[model samples]
Target: MADDMTDNMLILSMISQVFALILRSSFLSGGLGDA
Candidate 1:
């Protein structure tokens, strides 16, 4: 049970990282385009 919980947490962390990167990239592109 503990192992399963740890796995779930790890997956969630990875997903959050990917989402943050995507958001950051889009913001950068939009800002550059405006300039």
Candidate 2:
């Protein structure tokens, strides 16, 4: 149970980081990475 929660949190954290990077890059470059 506790382990499940930890794993979920870790996954969420990584996803959030990736999402944030995409958002930031898109905003700065004015492109949604659809080169």
Candidate 3:
């Protein structure tokens, strides 16, 4: 049970990180385009 919980947390963390990276890159591109 504990292992399953840990796995889930890890998966969530990875997903969030990926989303953050995508958002950051998109924002940068948008800023450059605006300039």
Candidate 4:
């Protein structure tokens, strides 16, 4: 059970990192277009 929980945590962290990168990229593109 502990190992499963750690695996889930790792996946969640990696997903969050990817999500954040996507958001940052979108924001940058939008800003550049607007400017």
> TM-score per candidate, in order?
0.82, 0.81, 0.83, 0.83
**For candidate 2, what is the TM-score?**
0.81
Please report the TM-score between candidate 3 and the true structure.
Answer: 0.83
Q: What would the per-residue lDDT of candidate 1 be over residues 1-35, giving only the tens digit for each residue? A: 99999999999999999989887887888854653
* CA lDDT of each prediction against the hidden true structure: 0.87, 0.90, 0.87, 0.88
- Per-residue lDDT tens digits for candidate 4, residues 1-35, read 99999999999999999989887887888854653
lDDT tens digits, residues 1-35, model 2? 99999999999999999999988888888787653
Worst 10 residues of 1 by lDDT: 26-35
* Model 3 C-alpha lDDT per residue in residues 11-33, reported as the tens digit of each score: 99999999898878878888546
Number of the candidate with higher TM-score, 1 or 4: 4
**Positional deviation of residue 25's Cα in model 1 after best superposition, in angstroms:** 0.2
Candidate 4 positional error at 35, Å: 17
